[model samples]
Target: MVFESRGEKVFRFAILIVLGLLSVIALLPLLSVISVSFSSGWVVDLNQVTIWPKAFTFDSWQYMIDRPDLWRSFFLTLITTLIGTLLALLVTAMLAYPLAKKEFMIGGILMVGVVITMVFKAPIVPYFLTVRSIGLYDNPLVLIVPHILNPFNLIIMRTFFKQFPKELEEAAFMEGSGYFRLLFSFVLPLSKAVLATLALFYGVVLWNQFQHPLFFITDTDWYPLQIKIRQFITDPNEMPFLASRQEVNYNERTLRSATVVFAIIPVILVYPFLQKYFVKGAMIGSVKG
Candidate 1:
């Protein structure tokens, strides 16, 4: 093993201290919310709950879980996240394949347009008007359709595909494979790392989408969990759209913390499985070409 000099040791120790402090700073809020969610309402009110529970209880979680509105929003977000990520992956892959080929004539022009979107976004008024005209007003698909082909994801995929082996593609073609057949059977099977990374990207975007759902969906029935939680958090009294409204025994503080935790749960659980793929794909895939 190589021995570190005195200066090197000090520098390494400093980096470790900084990283450890940053980790605690990040974890404190999450720990606090969980503690508050489980702690008794009176303890929470008295500011006794911090990073750990003082009087542990499940009252807040039980109350929120019992509400149908919460589940409706939760399931709607879940379905949208799953479907949106898949659709995005399929469409982006199909587009990226053609663009990766140097001979695809209009590919350069299309890429310019894609890059332009990265620099500039559509003005909200015109964007809203256009979507409304397209008949997506209060439609659930409004979330999925607009996000189907993200520019950043497209660039990452296209750049990665540009480096794909041409000989394999030629061999497949010589063996009588069509484009879709080659893609599904050959190219894609070898693309799991980049694809998994993009899926994680798209999945997170669709899952955490708040602005679009809040603005597009006026019908409370179609609201996602983020918006529903926002309503309950802001409203001093019972939320207007909650069915069979009645006095909640749980403190609003505990309920709010629970809702926040609930929103965070899916991401926390899903990220670990994709972490290995994501690290490689995000780093190498984006900068490779």
Candidate 2:
């Protein structure tokens, strides 16, 4: 076993302390939201909540649970996350395969074109007009289509595919398998580490997407959870519980905290399942083979 010098041990201890503090700092907002969600509305209004509930209650959660709009928005966001992750993974993998191949002549040109998008983005107004002109203005495809492939993700996947084994692919071709067959049967199944990591990344981004929906979607029925959460923050009148303000102990702050808590819960729950693959995938994809 290797032994550490006294200085090295001290430095390691300092790094550990910093990381522990940073982890707590990262969780502070989430803990505050949970605390406020359970606190009495009056205590919340007074800004009395720190890390613990002043007067613990479940009124806000019950109110949010009973609202049909909340459930509708929640399911819409969930569906979008699932569909977006799968489509993005498929498109990214398919496009990366040929580009990873040294034999594909135009692959260099195409790779340059894709990299250019990473460096430059289209102007907002023109982009808006272009999307609208194509008939995606107010459609639900506004959510799914635009985010089908992220350029950075595409690049990472290309790098991963470049390091893939040629022997397996050659054997598959000898057995009469085509490009699509090799990709579906061999590449994808073996690339689960990277794919799972990217899936979690895409899923989180789609789930928390707020700005795009506001710009593209005006139809109330098509609104996702983020839009609904915005309403909770800006206009408390949109919350149904306020109609009976005199009867219930819960107020606007309590309900808003509850909504915020609900919005982030799904992502937190999903992280652990994919976490085992995250570090390995991330490090391997970041560097050349």
Candidate 3:
């Protein structure tokens, strides 16, 4: 094999160094959160905790578990992530399929409008008013309804569909398969990679959604985990702890870190399963057409 040039080797080394630094930077905060969450109240207060716990304790996590309201909010977030992801994938795929075909009338105009919306988002007041007018305010549907179609995700999926093999559609048509049959039976089965990717995207968005619930959902019972965590961070005194204990004293930092880790765990758990599909889906969906 030929020896690499000095410049090429230096460039490769630099790229590796940059990527390693980025990885560390991304992971540092998460590690700090977990470490701080586990550390003793005083340790956290002193800001000693970093990559590892200084005086290890589980008081904050225990306190978090003791709160029923936090659990309820977690369940609400879970429900929204699951249902919202599924609905978004289905709706986005449906919208993208027809738009992928050039023969579809109004496809170009609709795409232009979608791009415009993406570039210039609507004002929050109008968005809230529209949601209110539709009776979604204070409803659980507030989390699921307004966020079903993401324009960026839609465009990515449209590109994926546009690059799909036309021969398959032609063969299906020749076999007398209808549009729904062709879509649901054949297209969807072949589109699993993109579907999984978009599902993850939607799931993360729904799970991390704070502003929508903050505005539309007034009832404390309907608050998602993020909103609950926001309240905790904003004012730890308002935390609805179950029972008082003298041995374990938790401060806002401890509570915030625990809530943050709790909220993050689900998405972390989910990413691994979909990791295999992510790169392929993103590349195919975004680069083609």
Candidate 4:
């Protein structure tokens, strides 16, 4: 390694200090939440719970574990995430592949339309009316179907697909291979990094689905995990999940923090596996030759 000058060393040390402070700042809230969740109701009420537990107890977690409704909502969110991600990958790939081809005459026009939608989102009233008209109102399918193809991810995938070797596709076509076979066998296998990245993107979005479910799903049973957490946050008494746990002495703060932690853990667990793919995919998808 090259020897650093005094000025360069000072600059590096300053940058390190700033980054370290920011990291601790970010972590403090998470640590506080964990601490509050484990603390007793009276301790939380006094606001004595900081980055360390004041009164160590598993009451909040025990309450969450015993709640069947919350578990059901968690399972629903998981299923929605898995199904939505798979469908998004399928739809995005199908749309992007044809748009990547220059020979497709309407590709540019369609792409223009997609980009325009990205620039100007549909107004809430019209969007809601459209969903209702499609008979998706008050349905769990509303969560999975309407938001399947994200325009930004579509563009990324299209750009990545455009970089594919045209010769390979031509050579496959010259042989007995059809479009579907060529796509599944060659294109998909080669585009694993981008696919994994997009899958993670879609999965995280679906797992954290709140606004759509809040707007469309009026029934408490159909609420996703985030919506349930929101309900607990806004009005703890109205949350049906805590109905059976009346004997538990958990406060709103502890319960809400625990619920938020539960909502976060699944996505955090998933990121490490796809992180290596994410950077490579993002670069490949964003950069066009």
lDDT against the true structure, each candidate: 0.89, 0.89, 0.89, 0.89
Q: Please tell me which predicted candidate would have the highest TM-score against the true structure.
A: 2
- Kindly report which residue stretches of model 1 are placed more than 4 angstroms away from their true locations once superposed: 1-16, 239-249
Clashing pairs in 1: none
Cα distance off (Å), candidate 3, residue 247: 1.4
In model 3, what is the error at residue 225, expressed in angstroms? Answer: 0.7
Put down candidate 2 lDDT per residue, 90-141, tens digits, no spaces.
9989998898999999999998999899989989999999999999877877
- Model 3 residue 190 lDDT? 96
Clashing pairs in 3: none
The lDDT, on a scale of 0 to 1, for candidate 1 is 0.89
lDDT of 1 by residue, 58-171 (tens): 878998898899999999999999999999999999999999989899999999999999999999999989998999989999879988999999989998888889999999
Please list all clashing residue pairs in model 2, or write none if there are none.
none
Task: Show the lowest summed lDDT stretch of 10 residues, model 1.
Answer: 239-248
Q: Residues 1-289, candidate 4, lDDT per residue (tens digit)?
A: 8999999999999999999999999999989998888888778989888899987889888878888888989999999899999999999999999899888899999998999989999999999999999999999999899779999999999999999999999999999898789898999999999999999989988998888998899999999999888877887575445456666667777888788888888988999999999999999999983
State how far residue 60 of model 4 sits from its true place (Å). Answer: 0.6
**Model 3 regions lying over 4 Å from their true place:** 1-9, 239-245
- TM-scores of the models, in the order given: 0.92, 0.95, 0.93, 0.89
* Candidate 2 global TM-score: 0.95
lDDT of 3 by residue, 1-289 (tens): 9899999999999999999999999999899999988888778778778899878878889988998999999998898889898999889988999999989999999999999989998898988898899999899999999889999999999999999899999999999998789989999999988998888889989999988998988899999999998887887477545256546756668878898899999999999999999988999998965
Please give the distance, in angstroms, between residue 43's alpha carbon in candidate 1 and its true position after superposition.
0.8
Which residue runs of candidate 4 sit more than 4 Å off their true CA positions? 1-17, 238-249
TM-score of 3: 0.93
